[model samples]
Target: MNKLPPDPAPATRLDRSQRSGPTIRDVARAAGVSIGTVSKALNNAGTLKQETRERVAEAARALGFRPNDLAQALHRGQSFTVGLISNDSFGRFTMPILEGLESVLHDERIAVFMCNATDDPEREREHLEQLMGKRVDGLVFTARRADRRPSVGVNLGDLPTVFVFSQSDDPRSFCLLPDDEGGAYLGARHLVATGGRRIAHVTGPERFEAVRLRRDGYRRALAEAGLDWRDDFFLPGEWSEQWGRQAVDILFSSTAAAPDSILAGNDQIARGILDALRDRGLNVPGQVGVVGFDNWGVMVEAARPRLTSIDMNLSTLGQEAGRRILRMIGGEHFSGVERLPCTLMVRESCGAQAKTLFQEARST
Candidate 1:
């Protein structure tokens, strides 16, 4: 009897895969529809009645059905994936950009392959090659600085490439950047409207293109307000808190009429200016109004008097870049540089009653 029971146990040839879990067929059966209709409803492809789509979705949920992404990619002949390569080591910029970009991508069930080049040319080249080999639908390159950098070193014709917060000399490239020049103009104008005369510009090195552009903006604002753009009033130094403090010391120690206000290069420097002013018994917004660029929340919020600064709208930029790349993937042609305008995040440090002043300035 035991020998007969053992003989009866010979296994069926059907593999375990066919025996386990819910598949599209299971959903179709549960929803009382064809497998093709289930697929169409789930993938949002081809028109279908709203009730039918809802029924299929309910069936999938109840059965715990998950369509295999690999199978779908194969059927569609597209990986539904993209590559994002960046050299921003200090995640201050890249993290938010990814957050914004991925929000758009997740809706379409697309995936991202992120690569950090670490500011090495060889490493960047290898990443580019690897992404291309993976047959990605599109590529995005980003960096901390707004300066021009070398292209990916390979001619990728019509591959839906996008560059953000950085640029290339290639005339045909689609580039996205912040309008730093206009931002600086806005900051300086705010100081003027706040009643700052003999204003000093304390900023980063002149070698940076951003610094130069901001300088032009400062000059233009001063010119418009009929204030003198004096050479000594322009203080160029490293973009650091220490430099901000040092510039303040140098300005106060001088025999020339001390600046009634200062426009710092970045948030860090602005915080330092505030700290130095505290040490020297100077009042902000009353004795000296202060404004900064790069309304970085970490520094601005933590500062003694929260900083009033320029907002680069980086998240908006990232979202727009994602939308543009999606359109590019759909065969849209875009070329040349696109500069997005920056906004002023008015706060306590600007020496005016924050609410009414911000409203008034925005109205103009």
Candidate 2:
């Protein structure tokens, strides 16, 4: 074997300074703070005065010094990153939450790692272990609905965690859920305010916790307006536009008087109801008012009179979750369930002109 041409002279290398960035020590000097303080400020751990942390951050930004020593940071049990695990494969709900969460964490220089568990137990367990191995700073769990589900099987051992669109069984666990009952109430009450009596609720399966809550809310709104809820007026079917179209015929045939207003469980059903009503030569908001949940823009915009719907405020929920989780990571404890209020997207479907209606004054 021709002796490897005397191990070809080693290729020339660039000096650390030539390809390097400002060091931690440089940041410390620029901020007039100790290296420990700089690490605390950048790594987001340990005790440091707020003003001093801000100074260190500003100096690091000015010098373009970013701490990239992962091993050293994890050895101290700190990582300036979070892990978000979601079961929503469609991203129909999770995307908005992620957008809000990133907006909050990005400002603090904390990064997030997203994982899709897709309603699989084994996959979720595996993701939990992997996130732990990465030494994430905290965890956020989001589901597609506000139903009670199994707790995280893995023992996170004091790791910060927040749940969204679902409630944990444990009272000590921090949970967030959209106020579905309140949302339905707002929809029905708006119908009443806009002169809709004989209101009928066409909704999804009753097995769903949200469905039952909305049913109760619909009844409550009518009751408050001195209108009794007729058992025949309530229709429960699968969550689909087809069922919505079918229900219209069923209601008209069974009841002596047709419902003047219909509150659909979701935008899909609302669109179907609108289509069927139009076919029957009924003028929306004149012959019948309509409302839907979820405020899904695609279906709402397509429906005649622009389907008035309840907004779950998923983005706001995500932002709030991010803020609270960060606080938990910083030694604050937030336990118990927090039900964020839903918003009403006022539109022509409810006999109201499409207009901006802020939530706080909803009753008006």
Candidate 3:
């Protein structure tokens, strides 16, 4: 067989024309003022007289010259661009969110410079420095952990930052997390309403805020139904299909017996569970009901049983993050945190009798 060549490298969105627009010196010449006076006026320095500031401003406007963001950063030590950093897996989850944010930021004409950290602190540090050099206005990071405090390169105090799809213990930075409590509550409610009791939970690593929140949501649901929460009924593992398989072992080994329904932390985990169950001659929704978080349409549709899951609304998540950053840039203030909603998607995995079977189950 003949071998195929590798794909071409992706083109960079950044270009010289985008970065190297009109210059401050050009503005100063057009304004007919000393470069220092123009700089002072643009920086809003009190050293310049009020009339002088007006003249400089008028000159800049006439010449169609805007302040060079790079030059302005060198003087005032702040960039207008915001630094966005995330890992590959997080990048996948954040794509829709970015789309949402872009919809808003594109209107504001503010640029978002992104970096892939690959979960490496060293790489993160390197990217952080690069963004600082670019004089980014603020930052938005999606990873749960940072190798070093952002202050190592950029001034976090003067610059605004917001975290999305992750949590930070820092009180100063704003955070937005998925509504795990709500998702869990809804998952349990769905199962119960559909005649599911003896529920099982396949969860992600406890270290992740999203994972923990989903687990709590499941627990709350179980409690609301007046059912005892069983630790043995829980399958704890990584966020992968393999972990879902591992969860199955833990589920069957439990003394209380395997559950009729399951709340998987995410779709990938749920997929593993579905496949493993089939290997054991189990019919999903008939022998076992399954629900997953992060409703990846392609994956869910392609699955044999077509897994039922929750939509974390990542696009909405991104949109909100974009809005927050724009608000900060535009001098609007937002406080505390915002939590987005999750939607429950029904499919065969939940074992809800087919809508056609609904009448049959009810008649029975």
Highest-scoring model, lDDT? 2
TM-score of each: 0.81, 0.81, 0.73
* Tens digits of per-residue lDDT for model 2, 1-364: 5665567778888899987878999999999988888888887789888999899999998998867757655656677788999999988888888898889989988888999999999999999999898888889899877788888789988899999887777677898888888899999998898899899999999989999988988888998999988998899998889988998888777639899999999888888898888878889989899999998878888888898999998888889988997899889998988788888898899898787664521222
Candidate that beats the other on lDDT, 2 or 3, i.e. the better one = 2
Candidate 2, which segments miss by more than 4 Å at Cα?
1-69, 360-364
Residue 58, model 2, lDDT: 95
Give the number of colliding residue pairs in candidate 2: 0
Model 1 scores a C-alpha lDDT of 0.85
Q: What is candidate 1's lDDT per residue for 162-242, written digit by digit as tens?
A: 888888878889988888888888889988988988889999999988899889888888998999989988999998999
Task: Give the alpha-carbon lDDT of every model.
Answer: 0.85, 0.87, 0.74
Cα lDDT tens digits, model 3, 37-93, are 888898898587788899988877876777767877788765656778887555567
Candidate order (lDDT): 2, 1, 3
Record all residue pairs in model 1 with backbone atoms less than 3 Å apart, i.e. clashing.
none
Worst 10 residues of 1 by lDDT: 355-364
